[model samples]
Target: MTGRHAQHGLTLLELLVAFAIMAMSVGMIYRIMGGNARNAGELETRQRAVVLAQSLLALRDTVPEGGLQLSGESGGYRWSIHSALYDTGVAGPSVTPLHELAIVIAWDDGGRRRSLELTTLRPQRKPSPQVRK
Candidate 1:
């Protein structure tokens, strides 16, 4: 080789291998980011459900004896609350004096249906303080 001769920077095969590695790295990063985003969305839905459940529980005294249904929208999410009687005890088929409340929060994310639910037991009659007889 002469002293002034030029040198090739990179062979075609080497260049192709480098491009493939870069592409794979980018794809992996994208997948991780996408999964993280999905998880974050799910957490938000769950938190909203918890808040709704707490609010409904706070209003337990307002719930009727038989059944209750509430539907509304908040923070770009639609929610529903269903209250009904639940019996687990087996004693002459008797119902408990408390009510079971279920709150569900739903939202559309990336053309997918996402939802969260929270269930709780609430007293039918709120306790009142009274002086002893």
Candidate 2:
């Protein structure tokens, strides 16, 4: 038993190495977590933009014959709605005209311009004929 002594604990060099490795691992974990948090925030912003776009599209039935062209800002986002006549290449007196409606939502994210567009087709409304008094 007196021939050799057992090593009871790590040396100073070994302890330093272990600390360095732990620091590196913690740094990597923090970086990953930060990225995930940023992604979640961006997703939330995009979802809000989609909701706003949908609400704007729901007003399609109220569009006038001359076509709707409106723009405004809401919740730090700028939005625009446009309508145009969509040609089906078919000509007839009884054919109902189709209108192409588009809504665009734009915002500035981290100094970058981001935008989303939603488009839909709707039938144009015709006025009713008046009867003689």
Candidates' TM-scores? Answer: 0.59, 0.82
Error (Å) of candidate 2 at residue 128 is 3.4
**lDDT score for residue 92 of model 2:** 93
User: lDDT by residue for model 1 over 1-133, one digit each (tens)?
Assistant: 7679676699899999999999999999999999999899878767776786577667665456657788888877787889877665644424346578888878887788878787887645534569799
RMSD of each: 5.8, 2.3
Off by over 4 Å in 1: 1-15, 61-63, 88-96, 126-133
Q: Rate the local accuracy (lDDT) of all candidates.
A: 0.75, 0.90
Residues 1-133, candidate 2: write the lDDT tens digits: 4978888999999999999999999999999999999999999999999999998787667556788889999999999998999999987989878889899999999999999999988887876678979
